[model samples]
Target: MCGIVGAVARRDIVPVLVEGLKRLEYRGYDSAGVAVLNGDIKRVRRVGRVAEMEAGVRAENLQGEIGIGHTRWATHGGVTEPNAHPHVSQGLIAVVHNGIIENHEEKRQYLRQLGYQFDSQTDTEVIAHLVHHYYLQNGDLFLAVQQVASELTGAYAIAVMAKDQPGVLACARMGCPLVVGLGEGEQFIASDISAILSVTRRFQFLEDGDVAEVRHDKIHIVDRNRQPVERKLHVSDLSLTSLELGSYSHFMQKEIHEQPKALADTIEPILEEGFSPALFGAAAAEVLPKVEGVLILACGTSYYAGMVARHWIESIAKLPCQIEIASEYRYSETFAKPNWLVVTISQSGETLDTMEALKFAFSLGHDKSLSICNVRESALPRASNLVFYTRAGAEIGVASTKAFTTQLVALFALAATLAKLKGQLSVDQEKQHLDALRLIPGSVQHALNLEPQIKLWAERFYSKHHALFLGRVLHYPIALEGALKLKEISYIHAEAYPAGELKHGPLALVDQDMPIVVIAPNDALLEKLKSNMQEVRARGGELFVFTDLDSHFTESEGVNVIRTPRHAGVLSPIVHAIPVQLLAYHTALQRGTDVDKPRNLAKSVTVE
Candidate 1:
């Protein structure tokens, strides 16, 4: 994942590009670089955070109205100044890339044979050469990118600038997100909203095959086939306040408290007046009547949301749903029936892997494909047959909080909606879950209130490097999310294993130095969790648990238990997740990570 920002502005673009890059720093921080077309072509790159890299650059000499910049996480290359983005080739052109180039070796060899020398190990280097090669052949920057992009395979979102034309920037996307923002006498382009949010709110979401040519005073669009297309102007709703830390020490803490509002915002539209799933009556009739099984695809925290939804989907909808990581689903070459429903979940809606996986499923003729995403204008939602919008409202933290819970809410709601269409759910069953959902905001509020206690616990264990989380069934996903939160922010080597998998191998890693956080709510698996606790205790593991008040966690000498509300089995995980998430957030804060913008992470994984 990386953050990319670029501009073709009428005014001095260096300051605008710099400001935009600063806002996007949360997305990726391993290294940062910028390329601008001044009087003489200028490019600066370094293997460090933005602040470190920027401090050493010649701010006065870096003059340009057209430029591109990137903060990288090093998916395809080692972290070095050469590996840093804004890769330059043939003297004038520079390109910054986000996603993986699955077929880079062949392209690299092809370029080498054609007498192009590369300085970096990045799959991105091929692009600079390709663009340079195309320009040399065609003498047109726009046609160069379009031609080079056509020959390119695998996912990429690239922004290129040429010294031959200092007032324009050319960008393209294939299986990645690129947006064109329209400002007065200026046009902006970036991987997502944050980069251009500082510049303009007016944007057009670039489609998969579209190539955008952003100039200082105009923006042009073209189809993959080179047909001219009209620019669709859209006003983004992102406000300045959404970009601020807003008195909170960390974005996770801010988002944790925003859950009540986020959950309420998501459900309010459905709860308004006499709302019904019949709003999707047409889709319900067409899809649920034929859907045989479900293929749920997602990545990271959204993947965890999908995992939790499988239980509800199987229990309530009675569908055999298989949750697959998006990166795996696309290339697995499975024998899915034509009537199999495919659902992709993403918080940003621009998750590169998930979008590609959904597109692959669609290409394979899946009868129905749907998306649940926070961003309404995102590519995944637009391409899917049905879209469920999650109004989580701008999650800025690199590690998700409200976005994860809201995705769970959206997926569970979508499952119920499907079940209602299939006539599998009784009226009472539907009403009960609906009632429980309505009360969830209050439950979430209560969970957020327990942050003080979680902070105290975090202070005690923040210094540890190795931590593990364990849970069974539904809470298994929660355990994974907890581990992700810790690892993403604290840089802690943490893993989440299924509670039953203790003896399989991970048991060997447990010791006094390892802090094991167990999600043991008062469910049917309480006995199983109790047995697992003994297993950890047997191995001299130090346990820090978020268990229900009614849990059978006795006064054990070597373990510590933090009590939570003894809620229902179905609602328990959602309630129980808050404290552990809080624990991770505070632990990272105490450990002095840039909690909102951790090292080598970004708010949106637009590249891959």
Candidate 2:
């Protein structure tokens, strides 16, 4: 994923564009650039972070009332300055874009035949050339952009500014996100809300095929057919504090600690008096009871959240649940039955694989779609028939912490709501689950208090080249998440398996140097998990156990135990996610790796 920010203001917009790029830097950071339309089209780009690009712009003294800026994630070419955004066309048009242009090679060849020369190996470069070609034909920037949108094949959110058109900009969106920010005497456009939040809170989200004409004092929006369209402008609810780390060392650590408030916010509606399935939606009471099964599509940490929900839905609601990696689900021949509910989970809610997977499921006769997401206005939530918004706020870290836990809270609530709708949960059982849900925030605080002792475990992990994570039943996904966190940030080679499967294959990798982390929650499988721990000990593998206070386990030679304040029954996964996140954060700190932005990985995977 890349970030795009543009503004048409009465004053010099270079500083505003640079500041907006800084807020959007978490989207991508490999390269950044900007285009300013003053007397002539001035372009400045660099092969590093946005800060480098800002420095270059200041050194060059580029000034304009209208400008567009971008921070790239390097999809089509190497992270070179020439491959950065704001690609210029014939000294007239400048373009900044997000998302892929699938047929760019064909278009590039055609443009080359028309005697257009190319400079960079980016799919986005063709956009500027194509728009310039159309502008030469019609002499209208808005019409030129509309014509070019018809020829582009893949996902794109593009902003085009012309040197001749001094105070004007045109933007179009197909599959990626673009929004128009309304101000008193200025107009702004960005790929994310955080970029333009300071400039304007009132914004209109452009739809799939909408084109927007933006100038210094006004913005006009229209659909593909050239008919004017009206869109509602909503005020944004995000504050700048959500984007800043108050006193934490890294964003991952801050997000891990933010889970309590996030969880409480997510479950607040369900905890209120007269809770019902209608709380989710008006049609939820009707649709949920008739649903036959559930098909969940997600990627990365979101997929693991689905895995945890599978246990809850099957045990509580008695529903057959299946989880699919969103990337693979579209290509697979898996058919969905009619009336089968489709659930999608994402932190950004704009993940392309998950969005495509949702479309594929709908194409196969599945009508019901629900999105569990943190973003209220992202594509995934908008495409779904029902939406459950998670108030996790903005997670800036590449490694997910608060978003994943809040997703679990949402999914668990969905399971409980479905159970109540299906008549599977009695009133007392419902009350018990609600009571446990209410305790999660305080229980998470208790788990976070184990940070000092967990630091000792982090010391053990510093030298571990390889690690094995083991869990049983409801906790296996937590084990997988733990391993994922360690590898994502610490660069450690980690693998997770069900505890019973250790003797089958993973046990052979056990040795004195390897630390075997076990998610030994005091549940029905606690004794069985303990026996598996003994197997690791017999093979000379060091044991790190995360358990509750009343557990019978004790620390011994080669084994270390960390206990929380209480044992969580049905809500154990939400509670257990904390220590593993902390473990990963501290381990990454010990390894001297970047905890916020891991190398070669972007926070949002917008491209395939």
Q: Evaluated with lDDT, which candidate comes out highest?
A: 2
Model 2 agreement with the true structure over 206-280: per-residue lDDT tens digits: 988999999878888889787899878889989988888899888888889888899899888878833376666
> With candidate 2 superimposed using the best TM-score fit, by how many Å does residue 338's alpha carbon deviate from the native?
2.3
What is the C-alpha lDDT profile of model 1 across 489-559, one tens digit per residue?
88888999999999999999999889999998888888888889899999899888888777777657777
Task: Report lDDT (Cα) of residue 499, candidate 1.
Answer: 95
The TM-score, computed over Cα atoms with residue i paired to residue i, of candidate 2 is 0.98
Listed per model in order, the count of residue pairs whose N, CA or C atoms clash below 3 Å is: 3, 0
Which stretches in model 2 have alpha-carbon errors above 4 Å? Answer: 273-275
lDDT of each: 0.81, 0.90
Weakest 10 consecutive residues of candidate 2 by summed lDDT: 273-282
- Checking candidate 1 for backbone clashes, the offending pairs are 27-601, 27-602, 99-607
> Against the hidden reference, what TM-scores do the models get?
0.92, 0.98
